[model samples]
Target: MSVVPAEVLPGGARAVTGTVRATVTAELGPRARLWPSLVAVYRAQLSRARVARIPLLFVATFQSVGILIMMRGVVDGGSEAESVVAGSAVLVVAFVALNLLAQYFGQLRASGGLDHYATLPVPPAAVVLGAAGAYASFTVPGTLVTAVFGCVLFGLPLTHLWVLAAVIPLAGAALSGLGAAFGLLAPRPELATVLGQLGMSAALLLGVLPPDRMPEAVRFARDLLPSTYGVEAFARTFGADPDWALVLGDLAVCAGVGVVSLAVATWAYRRAAVR
Candidate 1:
């Protein structure tokens, strides 16, 4: 604290003495790097949501499995069966990555949870990606189970099931980012929930069904969805002679979409955090 003479007025008359106090701001350490911050947030989110996500994961798996069972009677082994199996597998990803993630972020935003994260030193992208990755992680077991069950139910060859290694991350990235954007951008949490449900419903209707049976307009709409590329990549593997090039092409599309969507989600995270 210090004492100072008051400034003279416009009339050249000095005022009274003044006291001043200086604030010594504490310097924070350097911000965490992207990878390390991402990992930290990922671990925190993963550990925190493990128990809560298990039951929802079970439901996702069971729902996909039930779809497989129903489709079993409708479609004997063929391309249709391949489509059904692939779609059912990716549907697990959609359920957790898209639907539940949207709900999570919506609730977080509504409850001022973003404020806590906003105060952290982590990048907004890391926060968004970390949460998305954790929620997506919960879908792995469900996806695998659904895929295996679908294969067995439809008599599809399991030789290329390993392609799931690529499909999961790519598709999860795309869906989770979209979910986060929806949650963060929505004016209300309930609206966010509706958007998530609508997105999942679109996945279920457009993805699980055989595209050939769909109207031309509907097929066009299917082409726009990111998860459908993953489904296509996975379904292509079920053929007696798999087209590796086409499979890779579909995966590439998914990868591209994932990158774009996640970037958009990061932007949304920033926008939401500032508010």
Candidate 2:
């Protein structure tokens, strides 16, 4: 058999080479489906966060519980008590989903961790959603404890407490997206932490404090806050006859803001990844 010259390959050999090149290109191309990558990222994020975040979750729950205890001394009942309880419950979500997530992403960015993710075939949305989902997941136990504890402390009926099931996720998504955006957009990790802290403080004050107590200016600012909708949604449930329509509207607003914020975070992730 005669060996073929390198530059004068037969048609069959050329076709085979072309087929192999196409196969390699297809194998090396970007991922098409996002769900599998999203799930993998979510699981990885959840596992990494579980151990490191437990203590912070404890602190978040404790802080909200402590707030309820303090409010117990001042407000015995009425709308003020309801506001305090609802605000405190949502605060747990803000602490972890917002504050801690910002810090995590900020530090991750600052430490060049994005390089690792950037090299992967995963979609940018998956990283943002996975991290946000994982952080938001941590808020559940804390939020539930805070809500139940606040309800018992204030003598509120548990009948409407079920509203928290909707409140936590809607509120967590908004807050988590905001946190991720802050972390990804900030110039430094320290700034991200500061932004997170300030955001949480705003949620605590504007959300927990009765709207009646806030000045017109402060109340206007509160109205602009995404968590305000969540607070209103949760607080309205405490009443004997809640306007379910209004409660759902508030939740819808929260859901909308959550979508917008997550979109922004995804953009921020892409921007940061390219940097």
Candidate 3:
């Protein structure tokens, strides 16, 4: 039988609610309700997962902070540490890129969890939505940790605190989408790593290192990377102190790419799984 739209049963559970109730409810309860119960069940599941993963999350955060601190030391040295600054630039590009790939692919393979989602009554779209929310949630704590480390080590200022309000999330989401795109296409870990390196190279070529310094021929090739928007947003925010539109436009473009890529990936996964 074809998969049916899922509905919530009593006690906050979801079941495939179709005409063929016998087969569907034989495994999942029949007489399922709708949204509220489904949401409740999802929330309970998420709570349990967050609780289980809290310690691991903390350790990762601590490690990331240490990495940022070391990078920051090189960052604030100004021109005296030009090489360090370049390294920091490369590191940020790498950091942003890795955050996306690590979470997207690592969790799936490490936990061997894709099949779990395949077995659920929930729509495939739901997985992507949940993944997107979780990815967005990551941006919050990650940004906070990076910020604290930046201030403590490199002495990054909050002179224009509003700049951060607009900058960090957009950059994170842009990078996150690129990471997710890689996972959708990557068949093996080595291939994923290669893609990740390609992402870094593209970022450095177009964004982090500034295309302006490169010849027209060079920038032409790197223009393929979606990261230029993020870099431009940050650069304008700090260097030119231009209008808010600069960052907003950049963020919009980044978000547009992310949304489109996510949609395509989800569609591809669903068709492949159903086959």
Best by lDDT: 2
**Alpha-carbon RMSD of each model:** 5.5, 7.4, 11.2
lDDT of 3 by residue, 1-275 (tens): 64544553353464655675554335655532335434544464456447664564554455446555555544454322222222223235334434444445544643456666666566655555445445444445554554445444544443443544555555545565556556655666566667766776565445434344578877777555555665555445433245777668876886776677667656744653453
Q: Pick the candidate with the highest TM-score.
A: 1
TM-score, candidate number 2: 0.89
Clashes of each: 0, 0, 1
Candidate 3 lands at a TM-score of 0.60
Can you write out model 1's per-residue Cα lDDT over 245-274, one digit (the tens) per residue?
Answer: 999999999889888989998998899998
Candidate 2 lDDT, 1-275, residue by residue in tens:
67966667655454455445544334567673578888888899899878787888889999999999988998989999999999999999999989999999999999999999999888899999989988888889999999989889998988988888899889999999999999999999999999999999999999988889778999999998899999999999999999999999999999999999999999999999996
Q: Mark the 10 consecutive residues where model 3 has the least summed lDDT.
A: 79-88
- Worst 10-residue lDDT window for candidate 1 reads 1-10
Sort every candidate by TM-score, greatest first.
1, 2, 3
Candidate 2: which stretches are off by over 4 Å?
1-32
Ranking by lDDT: 2, 1, 3
RMSD of 1: 5.5
Question: What residue runs in model 1 are displaced by over 4 Å at the alpha carbon?
Answer: 1-18, 21-26
